[model samples]
Target: MEKRQLTYKDAGVDIEAGETLVERIKPFAKRTFDSNVLAGIGGFGAGYLMPKGYREPVLVSGTDGVGTKLKVAQMANVHDTVGIDLVAMCVNDILTVGAKPLFFLDYFATGKLSVDVAADVVKGIAKGCEIAGCALIGGETAEMPDFYPEGEYDLAGFVVGVVEREDYVTGESISPGDVVLGLASSGIHSNGYSLVRKLFFEVLGLKVDDYVEELHSKVYEALLEPTRIYVKSVLKLLEEVPVKGMAHITGGGIPGNLVRVLPEGVDAVIEKGSWPFLPIFKFIQEKGNVPEEEMFKTFNMGIGYVVIVSPQHADRARQLLSEMGEKVFRIGEIVEGRGRVVLK
Candidate 1:
């Protein structure tokens, strides 16, 4: 047998394809640039100038991935919206600290580079930046040979924002008698898909296109709903109201994430039955036989973002948020106790 010469392409990595994908994505990324963005794609690094108005500004940065939800996207052949989830998972965390998103970057890695799929995902990233009022300054796309399964890729996002030094919403100010106002979620926002996939694929053997009456949609659509972005509504609330603390409900649910924003001697008590029912949760619970506590621990349930304000401002805060088109719920209150969360 004659030996064949090996090349990078033969090894399944195509530098030209990666370059071509970059060319295809430039215009999409350019659409998200703001005046603060000082450079374009293909640069060794991105450049962003601080916005001029703040007398004292603090930089806030966050990074997050889409988790196993990427598998659901692959199964549905829906690459676009997971990018939105990628951006949401990070920017929403920065929002908890009262920062305004200034720019975003992404990491995209795959076994093989599919221009169409990568472009679709970038489009969603650009759209999310627009929704968040940030610029998609840059990103990296890696085509690793035989690393990820065919037709599979992973996405992560990084967001940078700025908050006035005095305006940072550290939970230090949270005290007893503060009210917790929860903002409704869009549906299963970017957490707990390991169990979701087990229920849908392993246990129930449900297909991506399978429809359930509770969700009134295909399994993939319901599960892959983009994570909600609370930037606009939250920024508006901070402008007009005083927020003692805030939390972005993610992997650990209300009890988990909310506790991060409580004072040492205070606790949050979430009142059950205070908000509208989210049907997808009921479906997941019944289908997986998942306990209520585990479900709350793993998922966001109906509430995605929580704001703790003094009791005097609770109603006004809710009214202001509602006026801005947020589905507001008086979910709980802070009380004197060790820093913790209790649901009753």
Candidate 2:
């Protein structure tokens, strides 16, 4: 008897499927390319020319994953928006330091590669880069048999940005009497989904498609809302206003993230109710019986980004951001205290 021949696909790796995905994603990557992109997708390494016009350019980079939120997208069979979340999480962090995002890359890993799913995910990533005014130069897609569960994938994103060394906003300039302005979030921007999942699924026995009157949308729709990329508006604001400090509110919500940008001898005193609480937060609080403090610490609440400016420039900054289509709010003010965030 002759032994049967086996191939890579038989062992759960599909080289052809991976190749097809690359072909499908090339167009999506192309639309995001700018003059500075020396090399893009399908290369051994991507190359981006350093931007001109800065006397002293500083490179800023950040990396982050979608966390357990990917589980929700997988459960709903929705694979697109999480890619945006992936880009937003990384780029937004670096943006806090007044960096202008230059280029982005992604890492996608799964047990088996689904060409269609991977294409959709890449399309969303390209869309995010377009929104952020960055180039999606390259990415890695790994298919590991028995590593990830069937039909599930994980996403990680990396972003590189540049800022003039003299213009870097390190939060050291934050001082008493500076006004705190918040840029409203587009509903649950890619954090705290572990608790969100428990309260909606295990506790309430809700399905992804189920709709509650309070939320006014399906569970997956609200949970999968892609994170807002503030790169454009904030970058524009930086040109016309003197922004003393900035914070991208993520995992630690207001208290955890806001305090990072507070200099010693001053505290960020956030005025509660200064901004409207989105209904999803209200639903989570009411349904899960979660404490107010826990809710603020775990999720973004309503504000996604915080900008600190002097009182003289506060009104002008708010006007500029609002005109740029962001829901802006004067959420708090810097006061004399130790480096901390106090919620009133």
Candidate 3:
């Protein structure tokens, strides 16, 4: 009797399929390129040149996964938007450090390879990279036949960026009188979804197809909207404002995220009433009865990014952000205290 031959294809993983997907994605990937992108898809390593004329450029890299949002994607059978969520997670963190995103990489794992499914995911990543002014440099697609259920997959992103040492933005320069400028968020942005899932699905008996105004879509569409990418518009305002520190309101919401940058003697004192809360947040508030404090610390509440700048420059900073097509609010102030964030 002849024995069966062993092959990667026999294990339900297909290199040929991956190659075909890469070929298909190349055109879409190229749209994100700048002159610095030295190579495209199908390379052992993706390359980008150091932007010319940086006095002392420091490379920044951040790796992140879209926590639990993947569950929403899997449940809804929507794979595209989660790829954007992957990129947003990394790029948003890099933006907090004043870095210009250069390139991004993704890691996708599934029990079985589906070209159509993965292609939808990559399309989202390419679009996200384009928005962040970054290239889709490289990524890993793993097919672990027995590791996950056939219909389930996971996605994560790694992003690299560059910022000059002298031009870096951090909390060292943040002072007591600096104003806290809040940039409004679109829904929850990517955190607290596990709780949301419990609320909408398990507890309330809501189906993915159920329509809710708070979600602004059939439950699935509402959940699948990509996390907003804020790098480009805010980077443009760097010229006119004296930014001392910045924070991306993510998993820990305002208090948790903002305090990451507070100096030893300065704290972020936020007043909740300065800006109008989006109805979605209010819906969650009423439906969940999530206390104001729990809501602020657990979710973005409304603000996606918090900017610290001088007291006198507050108006100009707020004005410049507003001029750039952003909703701005003087949400709080810096106070002389321990390095912590306080919400009023």
Tell me the lDDT of candidate 2: 0.94
| Tens digit per residue, CA lDDT, model 1, 23-139 | 999998998998888996888899999999999999999999999999999999998899899889999999999999999999999999899999999999998988888999999
| Residue pairs in clash, model 1 | none
Q: Rate the local accuracy (lDDT) of all candidates.
A: 0.92, 0.94, 0.86
Q: Could you say which candidate leads in lDDT? A: 2
Model 3 Cα displacement at 231 (Å)?
0.6
Which candidate wins on TM-score?
Answer: 2
Q: What are the RMSDs of all candidates, in order?
A: 1.3, 0.8, 1.4
How many times do residue backbones clash in model 2? 0
Better of 2 and 3 by TM-score: 2
Query: Sorted by TM-score, highest first, which candidate order results?
Result: 2, 1, 3
lDDT of 2 by residue, 45-123 (tens): 9999998899999999999999998999989989889889988998899999999999999999999999999998999
Models ranked on lDDT = 2, 1, 3
* Candidate 1 segments whose C-alpha is farther than 4 A from its true place: 1-5
